[model samples]
Target: MGFCNSCGRPIVKEDYGTNKDGSLNDEFCCDCYQNGEYTEPDITLEEMIVRKTKEMMAKNDRLPETHATAITATFIPGLKRWNPEFQDDYKTL
Candidate 1:
């Protein structure tokens, strides 16, 4: 029941991506990572936040845009893929 590192969606086994060696990549979801590569490698943190906020609004009509933005802003940075140190350590991964 862990969440996706990219979009914050609940992760199931099928949602996990494959690693370089074809093993499961537990940290990221299939939409964010495939074949050990980022689907949107050039996307900035702010862009991800904006995109996900829209999706959140669409998925839950009661969730206001402002609240979605706030939630994404607060949550994304803590995900493994968005962590500054983690990014710095594995810029290519």
Candidate 2:
């Protein structure tokens, strides 16, 4: 059976989301998605946690120092393709 990406619980058979490439996510269930649980098919388990932590920190106005949060520079080259905001040319706050 599939499992929830955020909580790692068994996902209901019908709750799988779509993958980045359009395949079935087979990770998160609908209940989790509807319950504000993190859901994604592109990022991995660890990546999701890190991203969520960063988001939390930003929301709380406590962004961690550079050394505290490892910047995955290698991701920029690929992430920029899907998320333009990550591009240097893009203007974001």
Candidate 3:
């Protein structure tokens, strides 16, 4: 299994995103990408971190808000969508 390039969620075949041509895109998860585009293309890394942190806490009730935020902040920037080097290529696709 690989992780989603956007949300860092674990991805299996079923969770893979779709390309514009409808082929499976192994780099991302369905929720974060579709039709070869980000579901929330306008979202910035900071916004993503905040959103994921909230979602993480909500989904895993035992996780604290601070920990969730920390986790997301630590990893989200390394994602293909947010990483500066990959951002240009990702958008062009």
Candidate 4:
């Protein structure tokens, strides 16, 4: 199993994104990627962190909002979509 490059969500084969050719992308999840493009290409890292934190809190009612935000902030930057070195790689795709 791998994590989505965009959302940092855990992903299996069935959760894999698709490329423009309809091949499995492996680097992202279906919700964050499709047809070789980000589902929310205009979203910034900060926005994603906020969104994921809210989603996390909603999914786990016991989870504190601060904790959810902290987790997503820490995890999302390391993802391929947000990492500077990986940015160029996606541009050529």
- lDDT agreement with native, every candidate: 0.85, 0.48, 0.90, 0.93
Assess candidate 3 and give its lDDT. 0.90
Decoy 4 TM-score against native:
0.89
Q: Is candidate 1 or candidate 4 better by lDDT?
A: 4
Q: Give lDDT tens digits, candidate 4, residues 1-93.
A: 989989989999999999999999999999999998889899999999999999999999999998998899999999998999988986796
lDDT of 3 at 59: 95
Q: What tens digits encode model 3's per-residue C-alpha lDDT throughout 1-93?
A: 999998888999999999999999999999989998889898888888988898899899999888888899999999887788887895586
TM-scores of the models, in the order given: 0.85, 0.28, 0.83, 0.89
Best by lDDT: 4
Clashing pairs in 4: none
Better of 2 and 4 by TM-score: 4
Model 2 deviation from native, Cα RMSD in Å = 11.6
Worst lDDT run of 10 residues, candidate 1, spans 84-93
The digit string of per-residue lDDT tens for model 2 on 1-93 reads 855545344566677755445555554555334433334435554564466456646766665645324543233223332344554553552
Instruction: Specify the poorest-scoring 10-residue window by lDDT in model 2.
Output: 72-81
All candidates in order of TM-score, best leading: 4, 1, 3, 2
Error of 3 at 92 (Å): 9.7
Top TM-score prediction, candidate number: 4
List the RMSD of every prediction in angstroms. Answer: 2.3, 11.6, 2.2, 1.6
- Measured with C-alpha atoms, the lDDT of residue 21 in candidate 4 is 97
